[model samples]
Every structure is written in structure tokens, then in C-alpha cells.
Target chain A: MGTTGTDIRYLVIIGIAVMLLLFTSFLLALIFNQRKKLKYQQSMEKLREQQQNQLIEAAVRSEETERHRIAETLHDEVGAILSSAKLHLLGIKSDILDERDQQLHEKGRELLNEVIQKVRGISHNLHSNILKEFGLNEAIRHFIRKIAQGTVLHATTALDDNYKTENPDNDISIYRMVQELVNNILKYANATEFIVSSTHRGNELDMVIFHNGDGLTQEQFEELRYQKEGLGLKNIQNRIILLKGSIHFTSGSEGYRINIHIPVKSNQP
Target chain B: MKLINFIRDWSEVWALLIPLIIILVFKPAKKQLRPVILYVFAGFILNFLATFMVEYYYLMPSWTYTDGYVNNNILYNLHSFVRVLFLGWYIISVRQYKFPFLLKTLLIFYLVFVITNFTFYESPFILSTRLYAAESITLLVICLFYFFRSMQDESDINWLKHPSFLIAAGISLYEVITFFIFLFFYPLHQKDISFAAVTMRIYTITFVVFCILLALALYKSRKKSNLSGVTG
Candidate 1:
């Protein structure tokens, strides 16, 4: 066995130490590269999701515009023509015609009045002028009053007096969603009682509907929403999505309940 | 001096125990890592045989000329050859590079060079410092390749938590630090016995640390397997 001097040993040790330091630095760089890659992937996923949501929003807005146009056409063009016809028939003097002919003219005017009312009702259902002029609360009240007159199904409502939306379009969408939900109940649920209530707290709005009827479980609701026969539920879902809101359905032996929450500020525009 | 003597005495036991533990603990869970585990287990057996032959030669010095060469040197050379073969297999198996033909050609060239040097130039009885240096540098390159390819992977895997990454890191760190040490082994042995002893101590310490990292890799692989089982 021979011996090398101390200087050479010291140099070797320093060299080994340097190599270890370099390896440590390389490991750090590898970790940084991985983290940067993960962050980039996450940001890309978020951008894709934002783009999809924007597309949905644009579609809902176009649909509302089309419905408004149709409602205006039915109300202004068709209803005005029917009303003028009724007016001219009423103006025909009873003294200028025999009894049977006068009776026939009066009957024709009555039928024209009925037709005019039917057209006006359809136009209102398509796009409610009441919702645009007076806001969501009055619109819902008027809707409930109309239903109560038409059906034996007892309907009740409790809406916040202070509930106000800066965007009338948002108000119309919310009103339409509630209308769809009630329509679903009328068509499907053989329930004796339907109850609706709403509240506004800070920038949030909560609406609940309850009924003693055959109800849907969460799975059933999801299944129905994607089916062809579930257009009303689908429409309600689309409007809620447009509002950036959430809806929950609860069902039990006693009844069915739906709870909805919307951030009013987030729904603006 | 006492610590150095202790490490020298028990280094073979440590080597054998580490790989044995890895096989027993992770073999059941690591189906994908079977080849690596097999290589390690084989290396451990080869190391044991080499150590036994060297110890027997020390006990009976006159019984070494059966094949016109020292049995200890033959055993050590065989051990080095087998170790390099397995290491090459590990690298090729885990490599993500596209040029498989080029990598295989380089590996074949390295094998030819090692055989020619051992057969013609370097005596089997002498330490093959040049071959060891070459092996260390090649392994370092392979480890670097693994890191680079992993960086390019699209899947968001936590490299720090990955078993293969941990093993590659350990190998890279050990190889880089020991490359010069291997190159200077014969020179240091000829010039200074004490310096050589110190260098051997450093190598043993690095080897032990490398073994610990390997054990951690096995443990992490086992944990990952169990998690996948639970989730699946």
C-alpha cells in the first residue's frame, strides 16, 4: 500500500462536493419545470371551460330575443286586426237590420272578442309585458291570480317586496323559469296545493316551491332533464344556468320541494 | 480507522440485505417493476459470490492458480461485467428516447470495448478503473435522459413522489460524485494506502445512501400500488 499526499485528497473531496451540489441544483430545476407545466395545464382547462359557458350564454340570449319578437308580432299585428273587426261589427246599427240579421251580427262580434282575448293570452305567455313593466314580483302575482281563476288547484305565493332587479332581462328569465316550473307541476303533479315563496338577502335571491304530489328524486330529475319528454324541466335548467344560479330538488313521502338560489349581481348582463 | 474497518467488514452484508428487503417488501405489489427487482436480486447474489471468492483467497493464498489467474480477480471481473449488463438493461428498459437502434449500438460498442480492454490490455487481477469510470459516465447520461423525458411528459405526475424518479435521482447523484473517484482508483491505490482507504469509505457511504434511496423507491411503489387498488 502506498500513500498520496494530503493536497490531492483535499482536491478530490472538493470535487466530489461540487458534483453533489450540481446534482442538487439539477433536481431543483426538474421540480420547478414540473410545477410550471402543471400550472400551465390548469390554466388551459379553465380557459376551455370559460369558452363553453360563454357559448351557452350567447345561445340563451338569442332565444329570449326571438321569443320577444314573436310575442310582439302576435300582440300588435294579430290582436289589433281582430279588435278592429269586432269594433266594426259592434258599430252596425240594430235598427238598420232585421231581428235575425242583427242577432247574427251581435253573435259574430262576441266570437271575435273571444278570439282576441285568446290571442292576447298567448302573446302574454310567450313574453310577459307585465314582467318587463312592473318587475318579477308583480308578474308572478298576476300569474298566480290567473291560474287561481282557471283551476281548482289551490295556489299561494309569498314574494319579497324589496326584490328588484336592475336588469329587466334577468327579471324576465327568472319569471319564465318559475312559470315553467309551475307548468310542470300542473301537467305532472296531481297535487291539491302548490306553494311558492321567494326572499332576497344582500345580493342573493332564494326561491322555493313546494307541493304535496308525486315527486322526483335527484336521479329521476337528472334523467328527465336529458329526455325528450322533459322539455319544461330542461327549459327551467337552461334559464337557471344563464342566471349563474343553483337549483336543488328534494322529494319525500309527504311532498316535493325545490330550492333555488341566484346571486343577483352575478346575473347582471 | 475503526469505522472504516467496520464498514469494510460489513459492506457485503449491507449490500445483500438491502436488495433482499426490497424484493420481499415490494415484489408482491410491483408487477411493472419486476425486471428491476430481478436485476437487483441477481446483483446481490453475484456480489455475495464475489465476496466469498475474495475471502477464500485470503484464507488460502496458494490455491489461486487453477486457471493461471487469481480467483479473486476473476470473481471481481465477473461481478463488474454482470453489474454493467444489468445496469444497461435497466437504462434501456426505462428510456423514453426514440433512437432505440442508436442506443443499442452504443451499448454493444461499450460491451466490446470492455471485453477488449480486459482481454488484451488490463490484467484481470488489476482493478478496472477505466471501465468503472466509463460505466459511471454512461449511467449518468441515462439518468439525465430520464429526467429530461419526464419533464416533457404531458401527464401531471408529481415527480418527487414517483418511485422511478427517486431511483433515477439516487443513481445520477451517486454516479456524478463517484465518476472521478472511479477514474483515480488505481492511481490513488498505488500512491497512498490511507487515501485509498478514505476514498473507499466515501464510496461505501455513497453506496449505502444509494441503497437507502432504492429502499424508499420500493416503499413508495408499494404505497402507490395499494392506493390504486383501493381507488380502483
Candidate 2:
């Protein structure tokens, strides 16, 4: 009886200890399992993000390619035809005609000249040859000069000359973003002044735009970027995401400002 | 000596009180945690009475005695009842399961079983091993379901730090460790008092760990307003 009692005692103790050990093992297994699940979920999210970025990159690239095609066609084909038509109109002798006929001939020449200028301007705006040759800084300057030509809005640029272009594709993206922002400002913002400034520090390029106009706050930008009408903003965001950069918008009582930060990879070595 | 005895007798009370105070002090999002708070409060009150009776039952009037022995098992029985009720309520409130009606029916059936077993077959004043076994089984099954569902969840939440996970873990730990002991508690006590005492001590230690986990869950919880408001 004594031996039996002692054996029972050992069995109970062993059972309890074993159960505890099992529970501990179970908890460890649970934690490890959860960690594995978490890693899997994170990898899945990253995969989705990469796929979405690829789609956006493809879309943006195709859009740029189409714009370049249309610009080349306009410049090389339509501009040449318009210039030839103007030359043919000019070849006629206006001095040998009556006063009214000469006046009509002069008007035709003036109209043809204006039509040629308009076509050329449209082609340049669509795809800037300056952007291809002189880089982003000169192209932006040319853009500002063109927009502020006869408009009430006084625009200025304080771009850093220290910037050395390494990626032309990134330059085109930056130029397009600037163009979209300025166009949005012209369409919606009833302001009289705008400033586009750039600073190159170390490996980062910072472009800050300040305007006395109604502009979106960061929250508003985030909210609007998911909307249908915000396609342009979405494209800008896609470009920023592709460049692995950030864009911040700030609005004050006096004016609004947007800061674009991009990490520029240098090839100076 | 008296103070030492008091501490020894009321050890589980102290363990239960820690989480109760933490939950009250932290004031976790009350909308989701109301059932948990209620369970803790109910458990604290029941445990305090049960411990108090164990310590001071000799001073009580004779009418309070059952079969000439001071039996505080009914308090523990009530504690078991509320433990299942409020814990089940907390689970039901949070998750959108397929069979809520079935869960509600099961809870009702559990109450009926407790009443029938205590009234007809076994006295509540004496520790009802059957009732405890049933409670432990029900809780274990519920916790298993909770775990299975949580494993399949795809949210970006850190389950290790989540309050629901911690509460489920605490309950599961307590249930898993002490289940067989409760199932054979009477037989073991009849055969060897010393062995039963040791097992009961293990139960006490497990309860302490459970309370600490509950405290951690409460600490990790945040107010609903804090959860909703976005910071710049």
C-alpha cells in the first residue's frame, strides 16, 4: 500500500510537470507560427506594392512616349506645312493689287504667321526639345518664361546650378510634375505670384514651389489622390513613389508651398 | 503568524486583484472590454468571499455550515459560472462568427447543466468535480476556436501585443494547466492530502501567471478615441 501510494504521487507530479512542459512548448510553437504568418503577410503586401508600382511605371512611360511622338509629328510635319503655306502666301505680289485686295492679302499673311507660331508653341509645350538637350533646370526656366510671357502671374525661378543630371528619365518626370502643378495653379488658383526654387544638397535635390494661391493641404492631397479627377495628382504620386522620394504640401494664410525631395544618384566617380 | 496565515489563505485573492486594479486604472476602450471588466470584477468578488470563508469560516454561525463543515465551494462554482459567461460574452462581442445563436444556446445549456448537477446529483457546497470538468472543457473548446480563427486573420496587427490574444492565452494557460487536477481533485485529496496540496499550489502559481498576463493585456489596451484620432 505504501509503495502504491508513493507510485501514485510520482505519477501525479510527473503528469503535472509534463503538462506544463507541453503547454510551454505549445506557446513557443504558437509564437513562432504567428511570426511566420506575419512574415508571409508582409511579403505579400510588398509584392502587391511592387506590382502596382510596375503598372504605374508602365503607364507613365507609355504616356511620355505618346507625348513625344505627337510633339515630333506636330513639329516636323504640321509646322513645316504651315511654314510652306505662309511662304506661298507671301510669294504673291500685294503691291500690284488694289487697296482692299492688298489689305486682305496682308491679313492672310498675318493669320498664317500666327497659325504657324501657335502650332510650334503647342509642339514645344507637349515635349520640350530643351528638356532633352539642356536638362531639367534650363527646361524649367524656359517653361516659366513662356507661361509668364503675357499673363498677370509673375513667376520666378531660383534653381541651383550645382545640379548635374545623371538620369534623364528622372529629369523628364520632374519636368512633367512641375508642368502639371503649374498648369493646375493657372487653372484653379487665382494668384498673382509664383516661385519655383531648387536646392541641391549632398545627394538630394529639393524643389520648393511657393504661390499665393488656393492650394491643397497634405490631407486634402491624400484624399483627392484617390479620386477620379485626381488622375494628374496620381501620376505625380506614382512618379514620386518610383523615384523613392516624398512630396509635402503646406498651406498658410498668406500662401501655399509644395516641397519635392528626390535622392539623386551621382555618377561622378 | 496571523498575518502570514492571512497572506497564505488569500494568495489567489491578491493575484486576482492585480489585474482588476490594472484594468480599472488603465480604463481600456470600455465599449469592447466591458465584458472582460465585468468578468474580472465578478471573479474578484467571488474569490475574495471564497478565500475569506476558507480563512474565517470557524467564526461563522453554525447555520452557515453544510454537513457540519464550512464549505466555500459554491462561491468557486459561481466564479466558474461567471468566468464562462463574461468570457464568452467578450468573445462574441468582438468576433463575427457564423453561429452566434449556437454559442448563446450552448451558454444557456451550460447554465442548465450546472444547476441540474448541483441540485440533483452533487451538492454545490462540496466541490463538484463534474461541474469544473464541464467548465474547463467548455472554456478550452472556446479558446481553441478563438485561436483557430485568429490564426487565419490577415490584419497587420501584432497578435503578441494584442489584448484579445493575451486574454485568450491567459485563460487557455490556466485551463490547460489545472484541468486534470480539478478533474481528479477529490480522489487525489482522499488518497493523499500532501499531493493534492502540491497540485493546488501549482494551480495557485498558474493563476498568478494568468493574472499577470491579464495585467499586460490591460496595459497594452488604448482608449477608442486615441485609436480613432489620426496624429500629424
| Model 2: colliding residue pairs | none
What are the per-residue Cα lDDT tens digits for candidate 2 across B110-163?
Answer: 889988887789877777778777877777677766666666666776666678
Fnat, model by model in order, equals 0.33, 0.19
Off by over 4 Å in 2: A2-12, A28-40, A96-111, A160-162, A199-204, A265-269, B1-34, B48-72, B89-109, B148-163, B180-202, B215-232
Error of 2 at A24 (Å): 3.7
Worst 10 residues of 1 chain B by lDDT: B223-232
lDDT score, candidate 1, position B89: 64
TM-score versus the correct structure, for each prediction: 0.56, 0.79
TM-score of 1: 0.56
Please give, for residues B1-232, the per-residue lDDT of candidate 1 as tens digits: 9987656866855755775686686563656566567656776776666666655555546766556544655655665566556655666676557766766676687788888998899987666777777677666766777777777777767666777887788778778767768777766767667987888878777777776777777777664422110000
The CA lDDT of each predicted structure is 0.74, 0.82
lDDT of 2 by residue, A208-265 (tens): 9999989878888888888999999888888898777888888888899989998888
Interface RMSD of 1: 7.7
